[model samples]
Target: MEQSDFYELNDGAKLPAIGLGTVNIQGAKGVNSVLTAIDAGYRLIDTSTNYMNEGMVGEAIRRSTVPREELIISSKLPGAAHDYDKAITMIQESLYRLGIDYFDKYLIHWPLPMQGKYVEAWQALIDAQKFGLIKTIGVSNFLEEHLEKIIDKTGVTPATNQIERHPYFNNNEVVETNKKLGILTEAWSPFGREINDVIEHETIAKIAKKYDKTPTQVIIRWNLQNDVMPIVKSSSLKHQKANLNVFNFELTQEDIQTIDLLDKGEPGRVEGQHPNEYEEFG
Candidate 1:
């Protein structure tokens, strides 16, 4: 899709509806993958300190012909760096590694609720924004309770909430909560980690045939139609181009409902890490 297909965040910043996710991809391969996606018209690139490839992403951006202002670069603070000091250091490190002056968006990678420092981490993010180290700040893998804690303590609602969402695990409650709070909902594993059951589902397959698109495209379109920006990862140029080709079609109301019925709630969670119960610091 064109860069204009961006959704306005709560803070009035624009985020591209579709982004290329760089998780587990690193080195020259990662650089090439990101460059390919950018050349194919993707304007947003999502990475994180946990991904360990912000350097590669930086290299891609540096080598690309695309202007820095024309791209929306995002990275996340690691859970290990959940305190104010560590969070500040990590944000600067990400910028240094990305070879950029500021991030289009910076997110707290996870709540790490068990560690009990996410509120402080959120404060650090707010401070980074104030310093112009980041243009927008948000969270990932944060449930409603975690979100409320930060908002209540800081009076600053996140610009967006990135979560693992797919047809199998819709997480409608979180999406609705973000919507109510004017926070955009971003879907991270939009294909449910390539679960065969979801990709091979009858309803998705039928809709794919009707739209002359793959189940992957139909699913991405489903996210867009539902107002959730989807970050899809692919190392292959072919798949990268295919993923961005989804903006041309529209899913019917009945088709959307059919996909909606695929939701299995918590049982369908691919990552299986409940934010409240997960406490990993590294």
Candidate 2:
């Protein structure tokens, strides 16, 4: 549980390898969950303006004894508000809502093709960082072309790229590209919502038995070994604490190879239409 056990981002910011993701967290439940996670040694709290729980997220941060310096809070800019100045204004609002003075990492939430302003929006994030309101700026759900566009336009690369990743829908190309660019690949949904249910899958179960851990531990161990930071969401106190217990054990190379076989090639349940073709965000 030492803060030293963190991944150093390409931009020089450090984040706990495992974090508490506040995606579905809401109202009082969200506040309580964040408080509990903080008490259980979680230093990273990931939220988004779109989650509509920043107020509760802010409340939990205020109530916790964890100092702002020790905590690494990250949130994203909504794609719909991608105009440069508007995005800056909205991120300032996000900071206000979270009751924090600055964010550890502020990402362009998604490259919503419908909005058609990601390059301009990315420029705004860079400008925000230069103004010292954000420590690091990055993007989520950006494919190679999108990433290339921003890099080409601004000569600045995202420090990280949050993506839909798990054993099932592992995007190898994205991972490789990000690695070469020094952009960290953060797994938004590390456990495919089915990893726990697949205890009967034999491979995971056997690995679990060998390590004297649960299937969840095996999956997390795999993520760690692969150098991918996994973000997991759980409101349950027991599960929240258990999720971070992954570092105590190690999975063998063979075990990792077997888990790799689970890749389904196709996107998992959360797959979106190609970023260029999809415009659903309003």
Which candidate leads the pack in TM-score?
Answer: 1
Instruction: Tell me the alpha-carbon RMSD of every candidate.
Output: 1.4, 2.0
- lDDT, each prediction: 0.89, 0.83
> Candidate 2: where is the Cα deviation over 4 Å?
1-3, 194-200, 267-274, 277-282
Instruction: Provide the global lDDT of candidate 2 against the true structure.
Output: 0.83
Question: What lDDT tens digits, residue by residue, belong to model 1 across residues 1-282?
Answer: 443677987788888879888888999988888899899888889999888899999999999999999999999988889889999998998899889999999999889877899999999999999999999999998988999999999999999999988999988899999998899999988888847578788889999999899999999988898899999998999999898888678888899899989999888986546777766544
Worst-scoring 10-residue span by lDDT in model 2: 267-276
- As for candidate 1, its clashing pairs are none
Candidate 1: deviation at residue 242, Å? Answer: 1.2
